[model samples]
Target: MEFSHRDDHNNLSLTRFESMLKTNNVLFFDSNEFENIIQHYLENGKIALAKKAIKMGLQQHPSSTNLRLYKTEICILENDLEKAEEILDELYELEPSNEEIYIQKASILSKKDQHQQAINALMIALEFTEDQDDDADLFSLIGMEYLFLEKYADALSYFEKCLEIDMHDYSALYNIIFCFDYLNKNKEAINFLNNYLDENPYCEVAWHQLGLQFTSLKEWKKALAAFDFAIISDDTFVGAYLEKGKVLEKLKCYNEAIEFYEMTLTLDEPTSFALLRIGHCHEKMGNLDLAVDFYYKTVHEDPLLDKGWIAITKFYNRSKNYQKALYYINKAINIDCENVAYWKLYAVINHRLNFLEEAEVGYKKSLDYGNYELETWISRADILTNLGEYEASIINLMQAAEFYPENAEIEYRLAGLNFMVQQNEKGIFHLKNGVLINQEYQFIIKELFPSITELQAVKNIIAVTEKS
Candidate 1:
């Protein structure tokens, strides 16, 4: 805030000073002075005051381009990009010769997700640039804009142009690598990176990128060596540990993967993905309790992590704890109710628990949402049978058999259930078909339908004995 005395020594008074202060309201300060005050407010972490000062400065000096620019920056900081664009539009028209205004407009457009329009504005900024010295910065910024748009070819061209203007620009070099990777030109990427490494061997990012490329090529040993070099360059590189763990997982070295994942977690905040992978490794090693523990930890940390819920539910089901299986399955469904797999798991656990009604509802929900698999139909049949709806169960089995004609297990289960409830003709037909499909039916044939042969062979003798 600036104050210039209003009058001569005889008239200088407290009342006059106060009146000047109230009317001027810091407006007497030049653009640079106001900007300094704004910057001081920002540096002191008084963001709202800084914004208010910027707005006051812009209102006081409506034609002051710098003041308007600062106000536009404040609008961007407050995430009111639409207002920023409106300011930029007026500024661009007033100062068409000022390339900075165009650049600011491009930035505001990019923030609003209008990337292509931002690029065109940047091109226009370049076309009317009276000063040649600022072209490199402008080109580099445009390259970044293209990169964000995923227009890799154009990004590469602009990045290369920036390097031609300033040969040692790090941003241009990094953008070149990114563009090559985006275009899947791995050979060129490797060449560029190798050259970069020759000049800068301690670059951890270069080593990590090389490791990723090796992993993509399935050269696991080389990938491991590259990641080791990366870790040596920067032991704190979390990405190196994570990528190494993933490569180990791909090589089927699950124990090594778990170790790497654990180390990565130590370097960064533990993620649900890492925890889930640890659970998977333990499950593969047959450490069921450890697997369940990790999965539970993951779910507790992030209830929206549907995979952890699925993993724990599968573990409980595998252990035949149908009640616990049902619990986690419902938790998963609650988190992602639209997912068919969660519903299927819920149905399966319910069926195992003999909660026939609940199981039927879950299976039907799954079928309605997703593809109807043979197992879903089979489970539907089993649930119906358990509910004493034998006819409905047989109907589902008949439909499932059409889809899985060679599934002798389906036929056997259907026949066994029919025989259990005294549906003799249907039981005989299915059992005979099951035997035709699998000749091993004789092993339990008599036990399954006890009266079929015994009653046929002894009915007359039993009748005579009863009469005598």
Candidate 2:
């Protein structure tokens, strides 16, 4: 049946079945009609009616293989895997060549989380199926099973087979790209998409995926050309427009980027991501007023979008408006205190405003939330040192050294902290380590440890390490 007429056909079958139900009269229908009626009810989620149709179908066509398979399908739907397996076993012995018997077995095994077993069943189904479309579906199913096993290369191979059988399989195309991305095969993905587009020239999805692969390789002009083709193929492709805007931004065409972003707002619902990008473009072009306006709109449009909140906070922070910056960052933290970046910025803002205690608390919160950036570790150590907690400063820098082993800045700071507490031997050890790693960072002592800059032991270690 043609797709356009399938609903009409199903409706006619449904009407006849419903009429038979109302009149309490037995109606004569071929096994095909009975299967259609059962399938239509099942598709419409009328399970009780589907079961009624199934019972009627079996009574009328007792030996119909397809109708009996529908019974196995219903059992699978109800998650009665044991019964489904038993039915499959009977069908297997009676009609070993029936592909659907194995397909149904795959479904039952999939429901039990036995993905490898499901794959084995689908492989058997593939061997018995002669229809090209049926083969494509089996390959797609096998690809999904491999995905569940996290075997991207195996999934990619099967999904590739799906496209080879039917180039119009968009789901298979997308899965192919997903597998390629997971495997970091961007160059291969580019080559594959280029080959596909040669035969299927107007495939908008292929063009869009090609653009994404080019973007990953930082081939900005190629990415722009691919997105342009995608937009030409389908002007209403909102994702293509958004991605093109990002490429334009990377190329420093801020005005052009803004225009593409605005086009998405007209084409679909106004998205916070588009609004945020528009705000950033304006900020880059020095349109401060327009920038802040769009930033505010972004947050108002989607308060849950943490990026929008951060943009607003950064805008105020850059303008040297500490009070407003603090207010916005506090709101962001209130929304998602678990975000380490938000807490890190909150700490910096509080420190600038001389709220040392609150800065200390914010830095600690950031660290607790998994902020392991070099600056965060260094800044927290600085905050402790300024608060006269020399021992805490030393301990904090010690943890930082584990992540950045042999880092000169960390060693320099450690030396300063040790010397501050009169631990001369430990101080000399770190000082030599710092100087040996990078003598260029020697100015750090003048900036952060000015009092220890002239210590004889510190100078001796620096000189000895420099000579060595």
Q: Who wins the TM-score comparison?
A: 2
> How much does candidate 2 score in TM-score?
0.78
Give a tens-digit lDDT track for model 2, residues 1-468: 211365776677778889999997999788888888887778778888988888998999998989889999999899888887887898899999999999999998888899999999999998999899999999999999999999999999999999999899999999999999999999999999999999999889999999999999999999999999999999999999999999999999999999999999999999999999999999999999999999999999999899998999999999999999999999988988798888988999999999988998888889889988888889889989889999998998999999999999999999899999999899988988988889889888778899997888877766775677
Lowest lDDT sum, 10 consecutive residues, model 2, at 1-10
Model 1 worst lDDT window (10 residues)? 9-18
RMSD of 2: 4.9
Q: What do the candidate models score in CA lDDT, each in turn?
A: 0.77, 0.92
* Reference-based lDDT, residue 219, model 1: 87
Would you give me the overall lDDT of model 1?
Answer: 0.77
What stretches of model 2 exceed 4 Å from their correct place? Answer: 1-117, 148-153, 182-187, 421-425, 442-446, 450-463, 466-468
- Count of clashing residue pairs in every prediction: 0, 0
Tens-digit lDDT string for candidate 1 (288-315):
7888889988998788877888889888
